[model samples]
Target: MMTAERHFLADDVPDRVRVGVADLAVATGETRVTTSGLGSCVGVAVADPESGVAGLAHVMLPDATGDDRGKPAKSVEAGVERLLAELEAAGGDPERAEAKLAGGSKMFDFSGVSEGVGERNVERTRTALGERDVPIVAEDVGGDYGRSVELIPETWTLTVTSTHKGAEEL
Candidate 1:
């Protein structure tokens, strides 16, 4: 539920706006937004390069249909809704939006509560974005490690970084 302190980046430089687990952030101008420590949680990033508007959400669960006990970004459905709204508020056009997703790794394998959580998170993310008519241009999901993501809206780039996979930009 926290957005990083605004940084005045000159032309989408490397200055980052960091978000935490189950948190969401929106940037209007030139800046990179990032989030970390994603294991079995999804990082959803969306952007409109034309407006230099973008948003990021760290989602931990598949759904929050009737649950309101925590931040909206803690769940896939609400997080997508909120993130899109925030981007539009920041002058992003939904019709021109594209998405990049990363992180949904099964970092642990406990029999009690760790089955398919990552898969479900990714599924819900796709479904939510589909409903909003936002196309997923690229993705780096499903694995056995952790990931962190950074989004630079001016170039509409989403960078996925992990200890195991180095770094990739989408």
Candidate 2:
């Protein structure tokens, strides 16, 4: 009998393919994958089917600060913007791409964190996508458990897995 291989390590990012975490990636016929742990942080994936380009955004906040402007785009809004621009540069149509959101768990009580950064991140992402008219095809948000998310560019699929929750197909 043949034994199947048990996977452990992450697959490497393809050449000329960019993987974004609160960042962007663009590729044609190339697979772009990104992963993140969500303990409150929201994991966002944006993909353009035509270009086979995808990006991931691990956003921790709703908006960016003045200092953030100089830093790499990491906020929900800036992250999406950067992803869009990179996709456009890589021959992706902004109008053709769709978004997927995951993560954002109330794993711990913050006492008083003001706005629940996790929820804020989720709401901000929704608002941003709505404004751009980009449809959010799937999501796994707001819970008491942490999650890990992966975006596969080839199939434009976002998979969410968790220790206690097993796995969710999205």
Candidate 3:
């Protein structure tokens, strides 16, 4: 029988909640939310500092063709909308909310695939946020490598980490 290894966080590292691909997470207070290995996928984060409410979404596609069967986090359009709604429900004011976006890396080079999925995801994400009147204050997008993102609701800071480029606060 094989037993799974248990990974424990360091003492200094804050508790982290992971938002997987095609998923979203919202948190308040000191809890931090994270999403990893974003290649063609995009991570959209929104936060309201006053309320200490933050939300993160890992969107895998630009838009949903039909229906996600109630799962909105799978597409950039629905995912961002869902995140914003959750943030507002958590006492975050829409007017005071700000956004940070990362990932959208062009991981492949197909001959005739005009406009890669990464670029499309970024564009659609921007449009969705714009429609909701959420201002995007920072972004780390359009590259050739994957990314990992973490959101700290307490400080309303988003830390983006990339294997090739290290980490930076957005």
Candidate 4:
């Protein structure tokens, strides 16, 4: 019986918040939202530089079938919508918002899986965002390694980090 582990930021970390898998976080000001160890999962971030409001969602699946209960951040469709709404509620202007995406890597090759989950996740994420008229400004997606991402709303920057590739800002 393996249980999910919840990691907390250090006491001195101030406004930095960590979002786990199948989770999302929204913040304003100089706060930074981060999520780690994203393989096939996708990290989607939306922010408004003028309002200083931003959000990050770690979506694990491409879409939600049947009943998804009430958690929207578990799938790309619901997750992107939920994040956009939250960002707006937090004072972000939808028209002025910019999105950044990262992760979604083919970390492994399965024997019988028809298509890679990473590709599907990326595609679905793009579709969802496009449907809502949110333009994706930057992306570091579709590769062979896992990545961690951080979003700074104040600066409207996304930093993607990988063990093999170091870090890049978008």
Which is better, 2 or 4, measured by lDDT? 4
Candidate 3, lDDT over the whole model: 0.82
> TM per model?
0.88, 0.80, 0.87, 0.87
Task: Give the lowest summed-lDDT range of ten residues in model 1.
Answer: 1-10
Clashing pairs in 1: none
Compared to the true structure, candidate 2 yields what TM-score? Answer: 0.80
- Could you tell me which 10 consecutive residues in candidate 3 have the lowest summed lDDT? 1-10
lDDT of 1 by residue, 85-117 (tens): 787777788889888999888877877666888
Please list the Cα RMSD from the true structure of every candidate, rounded to 1 decimal place. 3.0, 8.0, 6.2, 4.9
> Where is model 3 more than 4 Å wrong at Cα?
1-14, 112-115
Candidates arranged by TM-score, highest first = 1, 4, 3, 2
lDDT for 107 in candidate 4 is 89
In angstroms, how far off is 2's CA in candidate 2?
38
- Per-residue CA lDDT of candidate 4, range 75-161, in tens? 899888788777776667887877899989998887566358889999999999888888999999998999999888778889999
Question: In model 3, how many backbone clashes occur?
Answer: 0
Which of the two, 1 or 3, has more lDDT? 1
Name the TM-score of candidate 3: 0.87
What is the Å distance of residue 138 in model 4 from its true position?
0.6
The lDDT, on a scale of 0 to 1, for candidate 4 is 0.81
Top-lDDT candidate index: 1
Top candidate (TM-score): 1
For model 1, state the Cα shift of residue 6 in Å. Answer: 9.8
Q: Which candidate model has the greater lDDT, 2 or 3?
A: 3
